[model samples]
Target: MSASRDTRSQDIIDRVEAAGLRIPAWQAVCSVLETLGEVLPYGTAAYLASSLPDSMGAEVGRHFPADSSASQVDRGDFVAAVARRCGCGVEEAERAVHAVTDAIAATVPFGVMVNVEHVTPEPLLDLITR
Candidate 1:
């Protein structure tokens, strides 16, 4: 892998550990972040991007607040996006979402989670709430 890839991987691992999960959770969480970054409105995406490290900022930067409101995707579409991004089955993708978000809920500050939740759409509540 290139040095940049290695650095990005390391940054992700550090973040996963900081979230009280091991490195294994990185892909799922990254998928969620990318999907949100792709689909959220500019203000909402910026809210989430601000919480992430600089290394990760670029992954979502391109689509973060895409030109049209049509860029927004629904909850089922989000799950499918994660599945397609991870090359996993929908069930597994859903499980990963639940696991990753649950870890975030456990480790991230409550206020930050609330801020994120405020930016998230209603159909996706189960990703964090359940």
Candidate 2:
């Protein structure tokens, strides 16, 4: 990775770790991105990935197929997916989701996040918002 991307990724990891979720910050962030890959439209995911640090962007792109349509993932299922990916329990997964989303919100533009909120499901809205 480029120096800038590596620095940005570390910044994000530090923010997520500050949330005290116990799981590794990079793992938590990747798990959340993978779970969101199931919910966000491909275009949305692409836009989001573009805004992220290189490695995190690739994580989203890896999980979300360019041609695959997005799903309206239920909150329970979303948490479960994250939990499975992070090898953590439901509560920890939920915290990670919130922390990762907060990190994403900090990195991306406000308009992009507005678009993300528009496509995201109501049940899981709180997880994505600050």
Candidate 3:
């Protein structure tokens, strides 16, 4: 990877760290989403990855349409899925995802965030904002 790309990835991580989550837990949240992406339609995973740096987008995304009939998981289920991936309880996972999403949201304008909301379901937005 180019130095600029590395810097960009570190920039995202540095921002997440500033939001008060450690790298490992943030990584867990990301890993969980990447796995969830495999089972979901590409759109949700793609949009969710938009707030991230390119390498991270790659890290948390891979196969899509793994379940041909699958769609985006709702918020609670999304939390549960992430929890399972991180080997943590659901509530704990909620905190982790919440923190990371909040941090990412902080980097974008409110208008962009609203656009994100348009593509994202209400429940999922609640998960991030609440």
Candidate 4:
């Protein structure tokens, strides 16, 4: 990877780690999504964070139609395309993609919490930005 790409990936890893959500597995996922956000024209990172699986799957399918039948290839290509678009090295994009895929796999079972009354969005967003 190039120095800049390495630096950007590390910066994202460090920021996410600092957020107290640093499960070794999830860190990789967040990194990829961050990179995707950096690369893709559309807001994939935000969509992944907020959308349901079916919606995200459809979006992913629509934007990256590699082989109508083989979704994994499309997903991989999408990540690579996003990385290329974002100006990141291929290795960096691959790492980010793997990390994100792993993170999503792990988080799916836990489900999401919607108790806005208890959660503070600012601190979480601040943590991510910082």
TM-score of each: 0.67, 0.91, 0.66, 0.33
The best-first sequence of candidates by lDDT reads: 2, 1, 3, 4
Worst 10-residue lDDT window, candidate 4 = 112-121
The per-prediction CA RMSD against the true structure, in angstroms, equals 5.4, 1.7, 3.7, 13.9
Q: Write the per-residue lDDT of candidate 2 for residues 8-122, one digit (tens) a residue.
A: 8888898898999889998999999977876888888889889898788888788557444334467898899899999999999999999999888887788888999998878
Count steric clashes of candidate 1: 0
Which residue pairs show collisions in model 1? none
For residue 118, model 3's alpha carbon misses the true position, in angstroms, by 1.6
Summarize candidate 3's per-residue lDDT along 6-100 as a digit string, tens digits. 67566656665565543364576475456545544466566656645676666546664343434345677777777777677877676676666
Candidate 4 lDDT, 1-130, residue by residue in tens: 5565455445444543443432442334434444334333233333444432442323333443222322122444555664654356666555545444433433433333122112312322221221
Clashes of each: 0, 0, 0, 4
Give the TM-score comparing model 3 with the true structure, all chains together: 0.66
Clashes of 2: 0
Report how far off residue 8 is in candidate 3 (Å): 2.9
Highest TM-score model number:
2
Stretches of candidate 1 off by over 4 Å are 1-24, 67-72, 106-109
Ranking by TM-score: 2, 1, 3, 4
Better of 2 and 3 by lDDT: 2
> Cα RMSD (Å) between model 2 and the true structure?
1.7
